[model samples]
Target: MAGDLVLLTGSTGFLGYIILTELLKHGYRVRAAVRSQTKAKRVLAGPSIKALAPTDEQLSFVTVPDMTAPGAYDDAVQGVTYIIHSASPIPSFGDGEPPAQDQLEESLVKQALKGALGMLESAHAKAGGSVRRVVMTSSTVAVVPFEVYMGQGTEPDRVWTSEDRIPVAPGPYGFEFQAYSAGKAAVLNASEEFVRTRGTAFDIVSITPSWIFGRDELVTDAGGMRAGSTNSVLLGVVLGVKNDAPYGGNAVYGPDVAKAHVLSLDPVVKGNQSFVLNSMMDWEDAIAIAKKYYPDAFAAGKLREDGKQPTMALKWDASKAKRQLGLELAPFDTMVKEVVGQYLELLAAEEGSK
Candidate 1:
């Protein structure tokens, strides 16, 4: 049923925020698992979702501070019919040194795998018969190998499915790219192992999205750069810190990604499936579209001209998500315009307070 009880992790994150609202708007009773009860309340109290007017019975919060801890999600998983595991740490570059970078990568990959494995084990062992499915948030890095996406090789037009093996990180790739890519790839590898060894009493579906973008209504501070991994890039552009046009990469709307997670729970959704999603627009063209709608904000001195750096075309197939999940992806132009508009408002608010 569409109104089933759902437990959503990472409820205070950029994409998780949207997913939480989408679940509530669609009549699902959500028990959000966040790191802090106070922060979760602050997020749900934000004006963007206050309009949704979810009743007390419709929304709640559970604190799972350390996802890597043993049985961390046991209580959170209790009485939940579905789980949307969207919480994962974003790898950071420290001092840009190889060793520091290597350390960061190793730590992130290990913790990420451990957290995911913990959630899977908990859902299987503790949820009893209440849980039916788990939809995890993965990155397109898992689908498109870094070596090919960086234009060093002609990556096959592979349709990455649950059956596809997670590609290993190339030895020559940049530190951050290799770290993030390998971390996500490890998630797919772990998920496969979970299904193979843990059995399929509760099916697991992974949604791999490329460079998610959209307005973050919950970010009220000037630290937009810290809001999310992808948002940091977009916010960089908004703040003139990133002066490149088209920004370069496939972008997906946050709401649409949220919808994918929700739809993954549908009864028609098959077990142990993986889906790739993106809006299929170039970063440069997307910025140009945003300039069309917000000329003043994108005017000279604010937004820079195209850097003319060539970008690779999206290589992976996302048709399965559209055909099987019945997702009607939002237009890239509209998404860019809306996202920039909200970003400008945030900048204005920041300026007004200063």
Candidate 2:
């Protein structure tokens, strides 16, 4: 299985790139499905990818401009032994006004369903002979109820797990998070149903991870690091940024999520199952973790000692991930140090350049 060709989507994204590297590190050749050659080139040039220096046979790219298009992955899945479908639309976490309700559903909900379903359809129809497993990148939001994720109502007393399924919330979403959660839940449900009903030769493994944070090699400069995806949310705590509303205190390290995806490829691991990968995290604890790990950053005023970030302590049962994938999830402290450490490194580099 070491040299099996694996088709990977979302190689240009934060988690996708890490999954790419993990695949390569474990001796699996990857055929990355990128949106464009430019994005493919960027992944190759990333520090982690560049360090590996994957050979042509070990790493190559296919331009899949429109994943939601019919038969989008038909050609890409050819001759591939495994499919890691991690590509999906993400909501913009900027300061601007949120998109309209119709627009949100279209972009977040409809597009996600189409892309995921399309990939599975292609795999079943075209590569059923070769593809053994399809490891999908899902999210914790897919398992948790929308009201709990949105903080709209009372929090659930029980711990959420991979087996938990939440109905896709009806549209007219008030904000980005609600729509995003609906999209994930929709995809997870659709993906599992497709495999169960169709009975393809291959099985499906859905990896639902919580807030992922770690060193993002794609982020080059200080500014990019500060505004990076979920990593930014963690780093923002150190930079004295506060969330408008508190988010669930569930988190998983990036590499662990990636590793779980790779590990799921093993035939020994039973398929047609979902794995939740996360550990309970306290957002405010990031402040103390940052100060403890890298006191110099705070002393230099590079990281704030008085930053405020609200935390909603929600319990998650990720035991299935550990038991099945044999993954040891990283705690919030490791996540904070990695994010803050990388930001400080980039900040120092920026200062030196100036």
Candidate 3:
């Protein structure tokens, strides 16, 4: 179909904005479902989006009421032939649920699945013989445990992708990553059940990626901007987290996370093409790249000039994504260096103000 009318949930979100920008590049007719149109416009006006010159009408906005409520996307999913559901919770604090014990089991995860089922049902009804596919954003946490680290001999490349689906962590890392992982796992599992039970209205596929790091798409309001500044905090944490920094997490770039969604959206990739983006690294690897490419800044921070601290290797595999989705990832150094440069500039401005 020429210019597929695509429906994107969580359009106002960080990864959502990147997906919007990338989709716009292909001129895919997109409808971004936002909680508030006015707030969305402000986000669109931000540096990340303003550069794209998104047409108001082309970039249509819809009100996504409450995610917890099912059928929230009923009307929005009406005519959209392609659906990219990149909406999920990334915990800032620990999982707020009473028991971290209960959360690690599968509380939040089942919730997302419930939402996914609602969307799938809506899409099944509205396919109008046109709905081709549904692409969701799963996380690298879905691939396995946090122990899949580096080994002996040559650097055995292993990262999150579509093919692997075994738990590799020590099992019970915590409810935070667990909820996120289990939630994605629920959706993927639910999607499978959907196809098995519903008989393929549109093949369901998902992209499991790592922690996304990039500039905020829209500043939103001052409050929203402040909240969105998590982007910066996460980036800066690397400079200061030092040895005590938490490093056993999966990571990926915002653009790649968005692209993995797009690749899944393309008619070329379907149920057979589901995968994850696991181009993540240990804190040491993360720091090494920072120090190697940005010696001056690294020296300024005085963060491990000796060497990177040791970290557990996480397991990830991306062959399917490479072979099928055909994603050529940018170097890890480039991605980290770019963000570091942005951080350095921000620091300089902060110092100047003082």
TM-score of every model versus the real structure: 0.88, 0.96, 0.80
lDDT of candidate model 3 versus the reference? 0.64
**lDDT for each of the candidates?**
0.74, 0.89, 0.64
Residues forming the 10-long window of minimal summed lDDT in candidate 2: 93-102
Q: Rank the candidates by lDDT, best first.
A: 2, 1, 3
RMSD of each: 3.2, 1.5, 4.7
Worst 10 residues of 1 by lDDT: 91-100
lDDT of 2 by residue, 1-354 (tens): 789999999999899999999999999999999888999889999988889999999999999999999999999999999999999988775534567776999989999999999999999999848999999999989988878755676556877778999889998888778899999999999999999899798899999998999989888887877663888777888888866678888899999999999999999999999999888878889999999999987888888866677778788888887887789988888889888888888888889988
Candidate 1: the clashing residue pairs are 246-283, 246-284
Which scores greater on lDDT, model 2 or model 3? Answer: 2
- What pairs collide in candidate 2? none
lDDT of 3 by residue, 121-155 (tens): 87887557567788877765565543332222323
What digit string (tens of lDDT, one per residue) describes model 1 on residues 1-354?
567899888888788999998898788999988888788878878776799978778898888888899999988888889999998877542212334554655555777888899998898988887888989999887865666665666544644443455566644335565677788888887887787787757888999888787777777654554444466565454444444323225677889999999988888889788888875666556556766777786664455444243446655567888998899777777666766677677767888888
Candidate 1 ranges with C-alpha deviation above 4 Å: 92-99, 156-163, 170-174, 222-228, 235-248, 306-310
Pick by TM-score: 2 or 3, better one: 2
